[model samples]
Target: MRRQVLFVGLICVTFLVNAQEEKTIDLDEVTIQASSIIRKKDRQLIFPSKDQVRRSMDGLDLTRRMSLPRLWVDPNTKSISMANGNVQLRINGVLASSLEVAALSPEDIKRVEYHDNPGLRYGEGVDIVLDYITIKRTSGGNLGVDLSHQLNTFWRADYIYGKYNRGRSEFSLSSFANGHRYKEAWQDRTEIFHTPDGTFQRTQEGISGRDYEMYWTTTANYNYTKDDDYFLNAKLNFYYYDYPHNYSSALLRNSESKMTTDLIDNNKSLNTRPSLDLYYFRKLPRKQSLAVNVVGTYSNTDSRHTYREELESIPLTDIYTKVDGKRYYPLVIGIPCAM
Candidate 1:
């Protein structure tokens, strides 16, 4: 019940700007921080972006690790706070992915660097500050696939696949899922310690409820690399959630008969969230990189609470059956109220 409110809603960025700062991914090529770096294989540009950091470390992390220079992100809150402290990140003279210093998987990284001073290619007209991040996809590299499984109350699995090569092509994909059956029983007690004569009524009522859940999320991406060393990526991500519930309650008293009923039936919900990303990547000779990413998202929830009640033979107690040579009955006789 507590998980519904935070289903989805998030964003972070506090700064003045004139045209979005180029993605920090292009920082290595455009800024001076990436000066002390070396590339072993065919490369165009590599930069830093904590985007994956927040993703891999989401509320329920699967199996991914990230390295960042400086950042404060909470999984429960989905909020982030970062500062570069005189360090400016740039990509081809433009701002890139928002991050100060970072580390991530090779597939998600193009290049990396540490700049001591800010440069014109880093920012256009934004208030200059220290610290930045740049990131982009590899153009023609081979993809490495990662998958894992956890067998328990339900089957759970995660996957990651993507590649880049010779700075000319790129692609990536990730997913998480689980299925299982769970059984739980709940009992609640309420007492009104009061009577019509202001004495001790000691009214006690007990309630019980049960629930079940099944969920999963999947995302796919595609990228186009141009000879000019600029990368154009089209990303589509889809995620959803589903859960069902049931409930019942009862009341008892010494002077009156006990009453019981099912309060909920067929109460269920299905939710979905889809997002799109458009970003660019550029690499510089000095080991600096740059990138620009713009993303939009949409989410929807569909739910319903169903209920029902059925009673047979208006005089339920008068009608009885024989048990162990004796007659058993509900034992109730009173005036009915139409109100």
Candidate 2:
């Protein structure tokens, strides 16, 4: 009985030792894995969250939060451009413009991502990629206004309004107006010499008496989504511009002849653009999806330019130029399988 007792004790001791050894080995493995995970995380760049974005005022403010030196956002145009200028803008996986981004509010953004080197899937000449993910709002709207004045008599103003609902529909409207004036002065000298003809010398001084420009644009967008699988969007834009210029010059020839000339130029343009986009997605059996996209755009433009010139010794003449045209573009794409 004594020997059996001793054997049982020995077996229990051995089991305990083995169990402790296994536990120690597992702890070491887990430590290594945890250290590796930390290292991996340290190597990756962290993007901003929606909460952080909500604290910002507009897209420019959000860009400033990126903390990247190579990224820049123009305060006037509201355009984001990288250092290399090889970047593309997309909204919800659709091609977009800088104007659209400028109109976005911080609360509308979910996150922002930056890729120094993009893959072939993004197309060519894409050295960098910046993605602005938008939040899915339940039902809300936002309004924005931007105004600025410069020391050199330059000024700009913009206004935007957007709204969305939880019922798979959204709409937005934006308008912009800008105007500026500038003064300029210049001098020109000309000398002409011919073998048989006498030499001629001329000097002219010029100044811009009036230079002014005004521009306006209005844009509207409508979007619809169904069950997160289908999407439809429509956009319309209207634009107008007015420019007028006046100049006067004093001319001296042969040091004894003097003349004066006046010039006037006026231009006006109007444009309209409408676009439609559609998307359909199908889920496959093995965690896959098929997507189809179609896009169409139509544009019309009307422009008129007029110039009038009057010389001291010549008759006043007026020249007019006009342009009127329309264009259309259509695009279709399909993806059979996407993982």
Candidate 3:
């Protein structure tokens, strides 16, 4: 009986110890699973997440990371470009310019994706695409200025502001202005021959006294998200430009006697453009999404030219031309894909 009691107690103790060990193992597994879940939430491939790339660099830094041989940045404009053509930049899947990218800070970015082979929807000659996914911050802003001087002068200033709420709503506004002045000179020679008339030659020398330009642009964007499944974005843009040029030309013709013509030309032009874009996105199960975009643009141009000429020291004639035009463009695109 004593030996049986001792054996029973040993069996009970072993059972209790085994149960405790199993419980501890289960707790450890739960903790590991929770940590893995957290890690998964912190890292995402398609969108901006708390990753090394995002935490360490800004949008411009990300662009430099491409290390493409053909990629280059314009110091004067502070814009990035590829050798083939302009680099397509998209912010949250909406068309954006390099200036917009420069305005973004690292904290504002969620992810940067470089696409060498863009989808057919992106059109032809699109060798590269840089897409920026942005995070929703409570409030943020950026300011930038670029200045260059040589024979001509160039300068630009820009500002951007953004606001976001925990309820999945975001708003941003950006504005930029630039000015330029250029000087140019050229010479032209022409020879004329006729069956009945003798051959003659003409030489013309001209200089653009002044070439001035000014440009301004403003953009406003709004985004709304519902349950991480449906998203809507709206953007409005306005642009304006003014350009003026002055020219003086001296001409000599080898006729019976040397004939001289003095000319003055003046040209002024103005352009205005306004655009609106609407984007919609719907997320489906299994990590798929559908997107639709609509864009509308309206542009207006006004130009005027004045020309005055004197032939052989005599007043010849004066000409004036004025033109005004308007254009409208509408575009729509839809894409559905799995992530």
Candidate 4:
């Protein structure tokens, strides 16, 4: 009886790569030695389809959901960066991270499976060194509310909200209010060349473009499962970054004649990016599925740089006595003249 079943199975897979040659994978060599597990699954594992899975899961009302810790992925990549330990990632004729993967709905997902373990069947041939999770794919999220004060240098507040389902969904939102005090400055140095006759011929000046930054993120999400009944999977995220700076100092020529007094300058800039994601999934029985996901993002940034310098002469001390002058203008120096 067993030989007859095997013969039929072989016929189904007759398109073997090396048909002309014969090779056999010894059962002992193919076995993983985990006898207890092999026996346990053959007798208990269940591959439930949608109708059956929903029926089983619906047992728990919407009031409460099951929670299982699973790896979280970047969504776009089939890469799982985290795992809850057991690492059940693959099986005979089955693969993990397949496009038709069953997701209950962002809201129904009780737990996600994430196994970076090289021991995973899918990674048995992968090098052991490249198997760790990334910061973005970590499997932990929580909620918290914070109060902030911006009346001083170290004043700020934050709030957090997060959640994830075992089968289909995840969500989170966070915001921060802040106030900061800062001081920044710029410096310029110049060298001039002159002949034995004195005066000047050319100049070389160095200007440093510099600044400081501060910002925060405010965002939210609502992802749906890989189920057909749930047509839309949605997501949204936003962030705003800000920077304010102040600088001083610019070279005054005949520099030897100037006291090189101090100067003050100020500038401010802001940047923001907003993005939204939506997708659709359709499943066909016989283990086939298709999905279409779309993403939209927009970003805007503005910058302002202000710089100026002041020069004051020291007592007539004959030094640079040949020249003396104070420059007080919008300090706007337009394009330089070649001559």
Stretch of 10 with least lDDT, candidate 2: 11-20
- Mind giving the per-residue lDDT tens digits that candidate 3 earns over 62-148? 555534446786533547887666578888667787656755665566556666667666777787777777765443344333333
Ranking by TM-score: 3, 2, 1, 4
Better of 1 and 3 by TM-score: 3
Residue 67 lDDT in model 2?
64
- lDDT of each residue in 110-150, candidate 1, tens digit only: 43443333344444443333222224444333333233333
Question: What is each predicted model's overall lDDT from 0 to 1?
Answer: 0.40, 0.59, 0.62, 0.37
Best by lDDT: 3
TM per candidate: 0.42, 0.62, 0.66, 0.38
**Could you give candidate 2's per-residue lDDT for residues 1-339 as a string of tens digits?**
001111111111100000001112344534322221111221223355555576666665676665654777776656677766676766665555666666666655655555666677677887766667676554656656555545445444454544445457777677767776655433355555554555555544444344556777776777776655666666666666655443334343444346555544556666666666666666677777777778787778778877665676464677889999899989998887766
TM-score of candidate 4 relative to the true fold: 0.38
Write candidate 4's Cα lDDT for 1-339 as tens digits. Answer: 001111111111111111112245677645353221111311222222334335431211111222222434332221233443333332111222211121212223222222333433333444211111111211334333334443323334333334443334544444443444433234554457666777653222333334455666654545444433333455565667777553333334453453344333456667777776555555556655554556677777676654444445432222111112222222111221121
Decreasing lDDT order of the candidates: 3, 2, 1, 4
Give the Cα error of residue 288 in candidate 3, in Å.
Answer: 5.0
Clashing pairs in 2: none
Cα-lDDT of candidate 1? 0.40
Q: Roughly what TM-score does model 2 have, to 2 decimal places? A: 0.62
- Between candidates 2 and 4, the one scoring higher on TM-score is 2
Q: Look at candidate 4 and tell me the lDDT of residue 310.
A: 46
Measured on C-alpha atoms, candidate 4 has an lDDT of: 0.37
Residue 143 CA error for candidate 2 (Å)? 3.0
**Candidate 2 CA-lDDT value:** 0.59
